[model samples]
Structures are given as structure tokens and as C-alpha cells.
Target chain A: MSLFGRQSKRDLHSLAAPYALDALEPHERARFEKHLRTCDRCTAEVRALSEDAVRLAWSTAAPAPLAMRDRVLAAVRNTPQEASPLGAAPPRPHHLPAHVWGTEPPPPRRRAPRMRPLFAPLATATAAAALVVASLFAVQATRTQDQLDTARAQSREIANILAAPDARATNERDARGRGIGVIASAKEGRAIVTLSGLGDLPSGRVHQLWLMRPDVQPRSLGLFQGDTPLVTSGMNDDATSLAVTVEPNGGSAQPTSQPIAQLALKSVGFGE
Target chain B: MEADELLVRVAGGDQKAFEELYGLVSGPVFGLVRRVVRDPAQSEEVAQEVLLELWRSAGRFDPGRGSALSWILTLAHRRAVDRVRSARAATEREQREGMRAHHPAFDQVAEEVEAGLEREWVRHCLERLTSLQRQSVTLAYYDGYTYREVAEQLSLPLGTVKTRMRDGLTRLRECLGGVA
Candidate 1:
């Protein structure tokens, strides 16, 4: 009855049981994984189980309401960009004031502290202090220049995206078109949907998307906001209908009533 | 352009690209948080925080590690878990316990009523497990319950609960064909 020993089927199952739930003690799981490489049967079992767990996880994943999407995207828009950890350092700006720029200069290539006769000690210390000030300015200027260049390049890239042809398409949401806009797109897998011109919802309300197909009832694609777009799954041409509605802030089991605006999508297009 | 490409533009400081990337990742990011956090209001709050974090940190994303989707999901998961854990710590157990009392076990439900792209794969894989194994696995992963907690809830021995969870995951991995 004890399947705690060796490579027998029962023992393997017993060991794999915890691995399935991710409940294994770390050492035990590691040992089982080691044995799994050589044992095809165990490997197969583990794979099957993990997939089941993924399904369970998937079932529970409901789309977050539209307001949340707007909030997050809006946040992303405002968030500052950080320098690449791997990219080359930005060139130092030559014109910036030394005080405003880079790291302080190395302390006048400090000479080792020397014991001097007491009388001239003040003079020696003053000289050393003066030297440090001069070096600090030089180092500060160089670092400041580097930071300036990085900021300048980043700003230019941003300028280009704004100037791009599609920039207007995304930024200005159309009211006449029933608040329709394409936020972002991929050829095969997904796209971001945007809307505007729709009146704002009350505090607890959020917009939602439904992917309508002939074969099934409209599926709750996810939530969105009039101010920002949403990324919904299953956007192919087969996805005949796209509709929006106000649901409870996080969205609902289904569209409670008619959509605020319903648009038919012929095909899922790649982002322009 | 790809959504990730737009995100790269956003990182460069393009407002349009930032807007575009927002459209693409926002749903999953939001949905993921909502699933974990449960409260619509709180979920939205967490979602807003995650998005802002994503925008601020877009420059940090490296395509090498994984897709943009994964990057966003990782952020959402971390934030949601953080929110839940923090709230759990701040509130009494009884209050939080009342909040989670009515949730249904995913396995007991038939198939996902909505046939999304991944639904079939998800259903097939989940169906492969024995009922007990499936239940234990779902409670731990999706519900965010620990194995010991699951054991207590189901009135099963701790070791037995652990075994079922492991076996359940193993079966799922195989059924899904492989991990991403």
C-alpha cells in the first residue's frame, strides 16, 4: 500500500501528486523532476496535470472592467521611462553648467595623508580643499552632458510617434462613428480597441466588450473605458460583432442589456 | 505595427504609442487583477496602479524574456497578489473569510460557457483529471489556496491533499502538451 519507494508506478504517482498541486516540498519536487527526465511515464503524467491546472486558472480569468483599463493605460502614459540597463550610456552634454551636471570630480586625485609640521597645516588643508572643488566641477559637467543626451534622444523618439500618421487616429476618438477607434493590433492574435465621444459613466460603471459569433452567445471579451481602449481576445473576421456596454465596474456575467454602441468587424487588422 | 512595437515607441515617449499599448494590454492586465482581487472597485484601483507602473516601467521591458503580454500579466499578478496579501494582513480573518465564502469551485462547473480560443484546450486538459485531483488543483492555483488550506477545507489528510495537487498539475501539463 506504501508507494513511497523506488521507481514503481504507484510510487511515482504518489510523488507526482504534490507536484501537480504545486504543493511539493522544494527538495522532494526537485528529486521527482530529476527522476522524471529518465522516466517518460512520469513526464507524461506531469504534463497532463499541469495543463489541467492552467485551464482552471483560465476559467477564472475575467476581463477587468474598462475603467481599470483606462486608468492603467493612462498611468502607463504618464510613467517615466528608465534608461536601458544594457544600452550604451548617453553622451554627455557639452553646454550644461558644471554644477547641474554629472558626478562630482574625483577628489583632486587625493595624495595620501601626510604628517606635516603643525604650523603649515591650515595652508595644506586649504590647498587640498581648493583642489577638490576644481575637480568636482569638471566631473559634474561630464555626467550632466551624458544625462542630457539620453533625455534628448528619448524625447526625439517620442516626437516621432506623435508625428506618425496613425497618431491622430488613436488620440482623437470619434463621436460620429459611434465612439469607434482601433488602439493597437496584431495580424493574428489580438488588438487593442479604443473608444471616445461616449459620455462618462457614473462612479460605479465601466464599459465592456462582447465578441459576437453566430455559433455562440456574445462572450464577455473584457472591460474598457470611453477615455481609453481595451485589448480583447478573438478578434478575427469570424468575430462578426463587437459591442460595448456599461456593466458593473469590473464588468458582468453577460451584457445586462443592449450595447452602448455595436460595430461589426470584417476582420482583425494589423495595427496601422 | 505590432503592439509591442507600439509599446517600444511609448517607451521612447510617444504618447500615441503609449495609448496604443494601453489598448492592447489593458484588458488582460485588468482582467487578471480583477480575478485575483475580486472586488470590482479594488480591482480597478489595483489595475490603475499596474498600468501606471507599466507605463513608467515600459522602458524596462525586454522582448528577450517573454512577450509583452507575459510582461503585463506578470505585473498584474504581482500587484493583485500584493493587494490581496496586504488587505488580508490589515483586516481580521473573519471579515476576509466572509468575503471568500461564496466562491464556486471551477472544476465542479461544466465547461466554460464561452468558447474562447483557449477554451477547448483548457476544458480538455481539465477533464483529464479525476474529480478529486482536479478540485484540489483548482482550489490551490486559481483560488490561491495553499495545499494545507485545501486539505483542511476538503477534510483530507495533508499528505493526501499534497499528492492530489501534484498529480493534478502533472496531468494538466501533459494535457496542455507543454508549458509556455
Candidate 2:
């Protein structure tokens, strides 16, 4: 049975309204967020709304002062941009690979701004503010680094799955055109598929994914919509291959619509 | 410079960064608060407080989650809302009309306005909303009032206000060509 309530669905539109404005009550906010995990339609809708709201800042803008710019520049001179990878001394030139060429260290420089004693308080505020900013930078730098690491890990996993010894490739098509897909072991099986622009879905509908082999009918992994990134579960040893289809909200038990994305593995070492 | 970059510089104890950031965002921040709070002097004070808070809390900003502009506006919006709501029951709200706050910080926002990237998409979307829809969204968002408060302020039926807000935002999302 569907987990959603009728009032919930009716409230869906209203719920989205505050979310669009970022005015949702805490409880209502949590409820909508949980709903967002499954409701891609609402997710897409909310994003559009947020962007719309952001534009308001433009309509009501006033120019900042010239002195403020000078203040920012002067204050900026006090902070470290980033810790130098190489300390103090300049690096001796070396004949190395392309990646190493630009990594050399330069001369040490202290570019602190010259100031009046009376402006010490301002300088202190500047220093304190810079420290706050540095800490913020560190936090953001870590997050960016983490995101890069995650992307690299996911890429490596996909590469390993596709390059396995038992890998097989197949070409299949539904209403959409044919494309190549590879599956290694159904146990180790993973596929990476890409499609250009697809037609838009209606308000309540979503595109669902399916896995199919020769023996059993197509089984669903979950629902996906538009061009969002989707990762499927690791196939069981018994399962053979995969196919994809666009279906309504919760997806269907069987193939109710034509597949938009499909793939079959090449015979490398084993089929059993 | 971008808001994120300014925020980063500010976080590193750059008073110039704070000043720049204050200059850059203060107008919208102050204007937004002014629109909601409706007191020039109080709005400027709030803007200064907001800038100081930004300086203190610069470390908490996550650029990946939202834009620098959005982050500052969110802070401004929250403070404005809090200020008005708390002051709602007090007689001081009436006395605020004549007192105008003159902020040196406003020069920064005004300077940026000359070379700012206007979000035309939002402008167009907002224009499409009905007058009532626009009023409700502005009051609720800029002021931080509850839906009940919004209804009371407009003297409209609560259900009608809710529906208008919902429909208005929905159309806005559509007009803007999608959500975030």
C-alpha cells in the first residue's frame, strides 16, 4: 500500500508553497523533506521556486560604499590566502613530469598593511574577522575535498565493475533508440548509462527503473525522474541482466511502459 | 568579489572583508528588514548587528548548501522577523516611525547596485504573481510572520491566504523555469 495519506497529497501543493518561500514550520519542514526523498517531482518544483525567490535580492539592491571596498582589500591583506605547500625557501628547478612543474615554491613575502596606532582597534577587529573567515574557509575546503573524494570513489567502483574479467556487453532498445550496456557478474553487476534530453513528465508521474533477464520478468530497483543521478543496488548472483522503463510514481511490478534506458553484458568468462 | 570569497576573507579576520561584505549585502539586507520592520533607524541598527553576526558566524557558512546572497538574506530575514514579532505586542512599534537610522554600511550595497547581477528571472516571476499573492509572500517572507499572523494582518480568511500563497509560489516556480 502507498504510505502517503490523502490529506498529505492534498497538502502537497500547500506544503511546497512554504518550502518554496523557505517559510515552512519546523514540523512541516521535516515532513516535506522526508517526502522529498521519494518525491522527485516536488524536489524539482521546490528548486525552481527557490531560484525564483533568490531573484528578489536583485530587485532591491543598493550600491555598497567605496570605502568599504578599500576596507575589505586592506583587511584581506592581513589574512593568509592558503598555507604554502612548501615552506619559506624557493624551490630549485627540476626536470620532472607535467604535474610537478607548477608545484614549485616561490619566495617568502609578508604583505601586512602599514597602519596608524589609532586604528589599532579596527586592525584587531580585522584580525578577529579574518580568523573567523579562515575557520570558515577550512570548513568549506574540507567539504569540497570530501565531495571530490566521494566522486573519485564512485568512479573507481564503476570502473572496477565494468572492467571485471567476466564482463559482458549487450545492445537493447525499447521505444528509445538502442545503446550499449555491460554487466559482469549479476553479483558484481553494475551498469553506467547516459542519455541526452528526454521528454518531460507530468506533475505526479516519475520515471522508474527496471532490471530484466531471460528467465524472470523485469524487476524494479526504484523510481527516477528526468536526468537526476541514480545508483542501482548490486545485483544478486542469480539475476542475469538489466533494463529500464519510465513508469508512474511508485513504479510498477512489471514493465508497464517502454524502457528508455537498457543494457546487457558482454560474455567475457562465464554465464552461469 | 563573490559573497563566498568575501565571507572567506571575513572568516580569516579580515575587517575589510567584513566591511566589503557589509557594504555589498547591507542594502538588500537593510532594505529587506526595513520593508518588514518599517523603521529606517531600527533597520540600520539591525543591519549592523546582522553584519557583526555574520562576522562572528562566518565559520558556519556552507557555500555548497546555498549562495552567499541567500545566506545573508536568510540571516537578514530571520532577524527582521524576530525583531518585528517580538516587538509586535509592545507600544514601541508605534514610536519607531520618526526615528531614521543612517548607516554608513548602505554605501556598500549602493555601490554594488551599479554593477550587480540582477536576478531577472525572479523579477519576472514576481511580476507574474497577483497583487495579493505578492503581498502575502512579501509580508510572510520579509516579516517572518506566521500564517495566522498573515491572515490577521490582511484580514483575509486563513484558508484563502494559504491557498493564495500556495498557488502563487507554484506559479512562481513554474515561471522561473524550475526550482533550485
Candidate 3:
């Protein structure tokens, strides 16, 4: 979805720097981050900028109070380390020059052909160039049209989530980097769920989505593949959370494997 | 010991490594949190929470992904920023803070942290950014203002502020001599 939940990739790319700075509002941050998973260039750029931000933090080196360290370490001694076996994030490529995406590349240099003496030839060449440009633009327009059509189609249900007076978006990621982002309207009893970094599963294994309620069984919202966002209803005023699990193809009546990821749906709202 | 390696060891339940990591990073973590959170009690509280999180979540640190220092500072910064974002009526007063957040606020932060070599280096590089870019980076990073709030404070368009932050940080990295 764009900034208001209609995602335009160009606008989302510009958010990398702000995202690194922790400068975005919650819903916007969730949206950009959901975009970040599939975006390799932005990932590299964020890592590089994050390195710079870390340097900015290095100067504030006031020593911790003597008693504070003991408190923390004591807590640490009692706290068991998480058993999460997720490996480190894959290495990021080198950051590209800043503003590679911000400023448009310099217009391609046009070679000045010397057709000065032949007016007829110049006219012919001009027509051919115009035709080429038109066809190229037509191809681009078609692609944009297809994307717009998809956006419009999904907007019907998603807009219910984004436009709700109490629309709220939340995002959660596992240590493995698979994440889920949801925008839901409490009043409308509707939600839009988006998944990221969950790549294709092996044959016969599919990703399942469930609406976990307090008293009832985790209801199946249906299975998801690829990167499409899902819209589910039946959210009541309760502490509901979304969970995703891997199950055999078709679907499982219940989540078999431990949830690969889960996000609690707390007071979902996007008022800001 | 290398910071990430120590974190990995801590992940493996190495108590010694956890202690060693604390001695190394605790100051920087506390300082960064204090810089943003401002209040001593809350800053210490947030810092303690972040360090404890460092212990419990150490298993998630991937050496291949990034430096341990960067990862920990990120955790600290986010927690600090979130603390302020919720506690303060920032949006209501952000417009008023605009004029005050410019050179004076930037100067105070730069001067406060001037004791370290990296602080001096960062101050020098921050000087290279154009005015808007500098405001965009400093207000968000130091003052714990959201970019939207930064936009309100600086009276710049949101898009403009976002780009300035990216461009400003990019320039800072360049001045600091490119990505390592």
C-alpha cells in the first residue's frame, strides 16, 4: 500500500534514511520495513547508514553507575538466553552512493546527427524516433496499468483497514528475519496482514495463516504464498494475535509446527 | 575480545563473556540512552533494559549481518527514541521546538559528547552538512524526534526532510571516509 497503506515503491525507497534514524511514525515504519525485506538495495543502504548512525552514538560514553552494572548482570544471571537458533542476517553488500535513487540519473546524452542538408531524411528520422518513444512508453504504461489494477482490486478490502477511523498497523519479525506486518480496523472488525522474507517453501509444504483467539481454536484465515497482503475479518475486541506456521500442502486443521512468527494485535490504530 | 564474538559467546551461555561484554559496552549504551532519554532515572532504566535484552537475545546476533556494537546501539537507540516518543507530547510541541532545535540544540549535543575521539570526528563531519540536512539528522538522531516531527520542527516538507536525512547521513559517511 502507499504511505496511507497504498504502497508506492518509489516513496517507500526514500524512507531508508529516516528508517535508519528511527524517525518514522509507527504505521509508516511498519510499511517501509515490510517493503525493506524484498528490497536488496535499500537493505545495503540501511546497513551503511546504520553504521554511520552508530558512530554518531559513540561519543555519548558516560560510564554506567557502579550499582547499575550489578543490577543488570544479576538480572542477566537469572535470565535464560533465548534458544532461538536463527543465524545472523545475511551479509549486506556495499552501500551505493547516497541519493542514487534520490536524484534521477542525468538525461542520456543525445548524439546530434548531421542531417542538415536532407530535410526529407530528417523528417523520416524524427517520425521513427517518435514512434520508438511512443511504443516504449506504451510498454511502460501497460506495466503500470497492471499494477494499478491490482492495487485497485486489493484496495477494496484493504482500504477498509487503512481508512477505518481506528486503523492500526503492527509489525513483528523473528530472529530469522521473517516478518509479518498487519493493519487492522478494530471498529470494522477487519485486518490487512502482510508477510515478508518468507521465501518459497519446499514442495508439499505451504505457509498457513491463523487468527488466534483467546478461547477458540486458531481459525484459519487461509494459506498464503508469495508476497501478497491478506485481509481477514472476525477480529473482536480482545487480545488477538496473528500467527503463521508451516503445514502440509492444502492446509492443516491446526498449526502443527511451532509458529515460525507471531504478532500480538494490541489496540491496532493509526491515528497519528 | 571482539564484541560480536563476545555476544555470540554470551549466547552460548558463557557467563564470562557476558561480564566481559558488559564492561566494554555498558558506558556507550548508557551514554547514548542518556543522551536521548535525558532524565537520569529513565535513562538508566532504559539502559538496563537494553543490556538485559542484550543478554537474553544474544542468540539472535548474526556475525555475518553486522558489527555487534552497531546491533547493540541500534537496540539502545530505538528503545530510547520510543521512550521519548510515547512519554512526551512531542507532536503537540514539536513546532515550538523548531527554532530551539537548530544550532543551539546541535551545539549542546556535540559539545556534551566532545570528550571522545569519535565524537570530535562526528562533530567535524556534521559541520559539513548543509543546514537543513544537519537539522534533519541531528534532531531525529539526538533529540529522539521522529522524521515527521523533525519535519514539523524544521518547517520543511516531510519528503524534503526525509531526503535530507538520507543525504545528510550519506554525506556524514563520506566525510568520515566512506563505509568501512
In DockQ terms, which candidate is top? 3
The Cα error of candidate 1 at residue B126, in Å, is 1.6
Each candidate's B-chain TM-score, in sequence, is: 0.69, 0.70, 0.86
Query: Per-residue lDDT of B1-180 in model 2, one digit per residue for the tens?
Result: 888899977766666567667767877776666655656545544554455456545656667656777777766665666565555534344456635433211111122224433445455576788977876676576555666666777789867777777777667667766433
Between candidates 1 and 3, the TM-score winner: 3
lDDT of 1 by residue, B1-180 (tens): 676687677677676676777767666666656666666756665665566555545666676544565456655654565565455444546456675443333334344345665556666777788987877876655444556667888899976886777766666666776533
lDDT of 2 by residue, A1-272 (tens): 25577666767656665665556654676687778778878766666566555555545555433333332332233223333222122232221111111122222222111111111111112222222222222322334556545534544444454334333322243445333223233445554333323567777777666665567777776665344334454655555545666666777888887766655432311236
lDDT of 1 at A233: 40
Q: Higher TM-score: candidate 2 or 3?
A: 3
Clashing pairs in 3: A1-A5, A1-A6, A1-A7, A2-A5, A2-A6, A2-A7, A23-B147, A88-B62, A167-A270, A168-A269
lDDT of each: 0.52, 0.51, 0.68
lDDT of 3 by residue, B1-180 (tens): 989889989988887799999999999999999898787866776677678667756766777768899989988888788876655654336547673342223333455834666777788888889988998998999888888878888888989998899999999888888423
Q: For candidate 1, lDDT tens digit of each residue in A12-31?
A: 55656555444444466557
Q: Give the CA lDDT, 0 to 100, for residue B130 in model 3.
A: 94
TM-score of 1: 0.42
